[model samples]
Target: SFQIKINLTAPTLIFPGIEAHGPYSIVGKTDTSLIYLNNKDEKRVMYLVEIVKFCDATLEKVLNEVKLRIFQNKFWKKPPLLGELDLDIMKAYEREITKRLRHHKQIRRWESFVNGRPILPTMKHM
Candidate 1:
């Protein structure tokens, strides 16, 4: 699991996949993270389905929405990242889950390469 910081300027409106308002500095990665705004100025614990409303709503959609609000008109122009940049959730909220998928793919790829590496008998692991 990881954590994400909310964009300080994010809107307070509650939309699908959106929970509590923010200014949140360290939001948990789980869909059921208990840090949403509720009635009477209360800190409500959102259900897993509240933050993640199935297919109509998802972590990816939530990120995209945040990304849209963060970049506004420039969202489309943001350059695609080619490395492990997205793994660092501190720089900004993640806009795409592809990076995380890439993480697994890269690890597997590297593992295969390493496992298949040609090695001398003396260099083999005991």
Candidate 2:
């Protein structure tokens, strides 16, 4: 008779130690972390998902503002086609602006997303 033994261990998850959102990037850290540049060209660390959502929300806000500005008669007397405005490039600008704004706000890596909702926290009783 032969005896056999096996060893099993879960792999360690590697975190990037930073995160980004729109032009605003946050740096702090969470259980998991990643590093990325925020809007202000500052390098920081945070939870990856936090930065992604933050940047996304910031970008949405920026785009809406840009659209409104473009509609203003001071900027454009005549309504312009989306194609004429090179929305593709404008999108890049929006992203950059969001990044910058986030940086200006001093968002560091691992910070919570805007609105401060818990990340998947279960409903709590009062």
Candidate 3:
């Protein structure tokens, strides 16, 4: 899964908030969400990752981007691995999701999203 893209971006692992590909460092934004394989019985997760610079102008924008990405399902993070990442923004995101999506409940919480799609009731009209 370390394949390089034409633009040279690393392939991202297919975790929530991530675009499907082959790039990730095997981290997490929070412990609540988890990932697993279909053939083996193990739990896993890949949190969001972002590039940061050592300047005030970019520093001010970091928090805003974190919030924006969460709302847009762009990336995630796990504690300890990258402490600089702020997860407080997840509060607003969870509230908004409960308002807009059906049967989503609380993002990933302790429950696994079985097979990604079938966990939700079959939607014949899709």
Clashes of each: 1, 33, 14
TM-score of each: 0.25, 0.25, 0.19
Tens-place lDDT per residue, model 3, 23-97, is 212234454321222124223232222221112332233334434545444444433322234334343333433
Q: Rank by TM-score, descending? A: 1, 2, 3
Candidate 3: regions farther than 4 A off: 1-53, 74-126
lDDT of the structure predicted as candidate 3? 0.33
lDDT of 2 by residue, 26-56 (tens): 1223333323344565544333334343445
Residue pairs with backbone atoms closer than 3 Å in model 1 (clashes): 20-37
TM-score, model 1 to reference: 0.25
C-alpha lDDT (0 to 100) for residue 118 of candidate 2: 36
After TM-score superposition, the amount by which residue 5's alpha carbon in candidate 3 deviates from its true location, in angstroms, is: 43
For model 2, the local distance difference test gives: 0.42
Candidate 1: residue 116 lDDT (0-100): 75
Against the reference, the lDDT scores of all candidates come to 0.40, 0.42, 0.33
Task: Pick out the ten consecutive residues of candidate 2 with the lowest summed lDDT.
Answer: 18-27
